[model samples]
Target: MKTYDAIVIGAGPGGYPCAIRLAQLKQKTLCIEKESPGGVCLNWGCIPSKALIGAAHLYHKAKDADSMGIRVGSVEVDPEKLQDWKEGIVKRLTGGVRGLLKGNGADLMMGSARITGPRQVEVTQADGTVETIEATKGIVIATGSNTIELPSFKFDGKQIIGAKEAVSLREIPKRLLVIGGGIIGLELGMVYQSFGSELTVVEALPDLLTGIDPECTKIVERRLLKRGATIHKNAKASGYERLADGSISVKIDQDGKQITANVDVVLVAIGMRPNSRELGLEQVGVKVDQRGFVPADKFCRTNVPSIYAVGDVSGVPMLAHKATKEGEIAAEVIAGHKAEKDWVAIPSAVFTDPEIATVGLSEAEAKEKGIEILVGKFPFSALGKAMAMNETEGFVKIIADKTTKQVLGVHMVGPEVSAMISEAALALEMAAFLEDVSLTVHPHPTLGEAFMEAAAHAMGSAIHILNR
Candidate 1:
């Protein structure tokens, strides 16, 4: 048996960072991972998808460059080459994570770790060998979630697949059926759609992207429609049939009607369930809820104070950055430092064409909370930068308090808004007032100026566009 100050299970965005921080704080730490160090985000979820999205965008732009005076004959996707490039990015990032772990003096062990007691865990190696490990101070659980597979459509790892397989697909399907309209489904669907797949989105909810601002959702829906994608809301994928011609005939139910659509592949991105089962959580007295989420306090501590949980296994808003933040918090708390999960807002960015990024509250959310608010918007169509890039599909919207002039929220959907959302998150995090942003001079001919103008518009004193 080997003992350490801290033992982190699952070297994902959450676990690895926790181990590194523990080591940095001068505590002996060990991180165990069954797969890649950077977890789903680096391996198959966020990073790989973004690499493909970037390539597709570049290809699409080149193919449509006639209006920009750069005429290209034709554009095509080399799936094998693209996958190689994406894998290269993932490899570099995961390698960096490994370097960070080693540089920080954290031990990296490749195995499956399970809590055998409050301070003890058993690691099972690939060679069917089990090793006992003990943590004197804390044990951090960072195992992430897994894709929800429907009973009717089991993943064949080919024709029927989940988001994991969908991202690595080489052969571009002529027709693709995506069974969810949320972030995962829309993102991967758009990637294939750009690669020339006829897309049909079936969403069980009445609307797509349920929690986001409806106006922003509408803009994305318009873009999807323009891309020749079919959307069916309030619909359910009952089952599918494999035709003799090797195509899939998917049967969907929408409002008491049976609709059948034939496609080459089906991507099920409905949602993810927490990977809280097994690993002896219940045996160690950790409270996992009915839905499988191991609840944690603001400090990321589970019911058992000695055992902490982070990432998707911890709670909702299952973002990699969120998990990373919580991971750091848990590490610090375990190391006898003053750290807690404190933040005004955790921003969310959807990597769709033109993109949608948001932080803090929305207008509808504020109004529903019974707070009077002011809404200000500036369109990318009027921005010099947007016009120069030939991508003017969305706008910047700011929601502020009608009384105090405090900026309540910022929402944007346009080119590179994903990179600009951090500023909004900072503004909200610091509780900046509308004038604090409006009065601050933003660099000219940049997408960031929209934020300043949107703030000014909320104050009814915008410069580029009329104040509303």
Candidate 2:
């Protein structure tokens, strides 16, 4: 048995960072991964999808170049070349992650790891050989999550596909049916739409991006509609019939009426579930919830003192950044350092045409909690930079506590707002008052000013817009 101070199972964003931090603290660390070092985000989901989105964005821009006084005849997209480029990016990133693990003095073992016992791990190699690893101190579980598959529509890895398969699709479908209208659906929908596919989004929720601000989603819905994507909200998919030609007829019920639509491909982006199965958690003292999520305390410590869980296995807001932060905190706590996982903001970004970013509580969430709040908004249409760039599509909204005037949430939907959302997240994390954000001078002729302006509007001191 190989002994170590700390053993991290699943070298995902969460596990890797935890292992690295543990190594930095002068502890012997070992990280075991069934797949690649960088996890799903690096290998398939996040990075590859974003790369495709970038290519689609460039294609759309080139197609619209004629309107910008540049005469561009016909634009073309080569999915083969795009796939090659995306693969290159993925290889480089995963390679970098592998280097970091080695440099940090963490043992990178390629295999599936399970909690055989408290402070004990069993790694099953690809060759069907099992090796036992014992950690003297603790173990961190960051196995992450997998795409949810519905009963009626099982992913065959071909016709019925998930985000992973859709990323590298060679031929664009003439008609595509996206099963969910969440972040992944809309993002992939945009990509296919850019590739000249007639895309239709069918969501069971009343609105797209069910948890986000309704007003913000409205703008995206409008843009998607304008771009030729049909949305059917409050719709439930009944079943699908596969034709001899490989096309599918999808039966959907929207408020009692059964509507059938035919499409060349169906992409399921409903949601993801925790990958806590087969990790031998039950064999140990660690308790897993009904949905297969390992519950952990604030510092990511599981019921078992020597075992901890992070990322998707720990549940909600299954984002890479969240996992990374949790990994750091878990390591710090293990190293005898003062660390707390409590934070006011963990930002969520949607990579649609007009990207959506939200941090902290929305107006509805505040109202549901019976907290008195005030909201302010700044339209991108009024921003000089937005107009100049011809990318005016959405707005910035700020929600604050009515009593303390503390900024509660910042939601934005516009071009590249994903990059600008970190500012809002940082402010909310620091418990910054509205006045602090408003007083911070944001440079003129930029999208960032919209955030500051929104904060100013909350205080009724915005100079850009007249008093409403």
Candidate 3:
């Protein structure tokens, strides 16, 4: 039997960070993982998909460089070579994650871990070896989530696939039928679309990219339409049939009308379900919600005092950064340090054709809550940097209290908004006012200027553009 101060399960973004922080706090810790160190976000979802998206963007740009007077003879995407490049990046990142865990003084073990008692865990190794480890301090669960697969459209890992398979495609399908219009679907769908797959997106919701600012969503929708992609909203994927010619006939029911779309591949990216079941959670008496999410307190503690849960298994807003933050908080609590999940806002980014990034509340959310809010808007088309880059298709919107001018939310869609939203997050976290941002000097000829300009526009003292 092996004993430690704490044992962290699932060495994903959340688990590894928790173990590292625990070790740094001078607590002997062990981190166990059944698969890769970086988990799904690094090995499959975020890193690999971003690599493909970058490749697709470059490929599309090279193919259409005639407008910029940079003509090319023939620009094509070699899928095999592209996959190799993506794999290399994944290999490096995963290796780095493992190195970080080891360097932080956390013992890394590759095995399947199960909680058998409040202070004991069972580890099953790959070579049919089982060992019992005792955690003297606490145990943290950060197992993350698994992709949701529809019962009617199970994955064959060939024609029918999930987001994991979608990112690792060696051959671009002639026509792609995406079942959901959420973040995962659109992000990966647009990647394939840019790679010359005729895209047909069928979202069950009334619109695409739900829960985001509708204005930002509309801009992305327009771009999707302009690029010759088909969209079907308020549509339900009833079923599908395999054709004789290596094609799939998808039946979508939209407003009681059955529309059939024939495509070479069907991607099911509805959403991810928390990987909460069958971990002996029931035997350990941890309260998992009906939706398979293990409920945890602000301190990341479960029903048991010695047990904690974090990351996707914890709750909604299951982002990688959010998971890492929770992991640190849990680690601190175990070390007798004062820590809690107290953050003003968490930002979300969508890697569509024109990226959408936002922090804090949306305008609709503020209005629905009956808060009197003032909005400031600045278009990328009006930005000098956007014009210089020739990528002006979205805007920056700042939401604030009409009376106090305290910043409430910031929403942006356009070039590199993912990197720009961090400033908004900092402003919100620091409780900065609209004037605090507007009065600050932003460097000229950069996308960041749009944030300052937007704040000024909200204050009704704009220099470049007219105030709304």
**Model 2 accuracy (lDDT, Cα):** 0.91
Provide the lDDT at 419 for model 3. 95
TM of each candidate vs. truth: 0.99, 0.98, 0.99
* Clashing residue pairs for model 2: none
Off by over 4 Å in 3: none
Task: State how far residue 129 of model 2 sits from its true place (Å).
Answer: 1.7
**Tens digit of lDDT per residue, candidate 3, span 194-273?**
98999999999998999999999999999899999999999988899999998999999999899999999999999999
Higher-ranked by lDDT: 2 or 3: 3
lDDT (Cα, 0-100) at 376 in candidate 2 = 86
Please report, as a residue range, the 10-residue window in candidate 3 with the lowest summed lDDT. 276-285
Q: What does candidate 1's lDDT look like per residue over 1-468, in tens digits?
A: 899999999888888889999999999999999988998888999999999899889988998899899978868789998888888899999999999999999999998888999999999999989999999999999999999999999999999999899889888989999999999999899999999999999999999888888889899999899999999999999999999999999999999999999999999999999888878999989999998999999989999989999999998899999999999999999899999988988999999987999999998889889999988899999899999999998999999899998888999998999999999999998888999999889988898999998998888898889865
Off by over 4 Å in 1: none
**Model 1, position 194: C-alpha lDDT score:** 92
Q: Lowest summed lDDT over 10 consecutive residues: which window, candidate 1? A: 459-468
Residue 6 local lDDT, model 2: 91
Candidate 2 C-alpha lDDT tens digits along 1-468: 889999999888999999999999999999999999899999888999999998999899889888788878888888888899999999999999999999999999998887889988999999999999999888999999999999999999877999989998988889999999999999998999998999999999889988888998999899889988888999988899988887899999999899998999999999998999889889897999998899999989999998999998898889999999999999988888999788877999999988999999999999999999988899998899998888988999999999999988999999899999999999988999899999999988789999989988988999887645
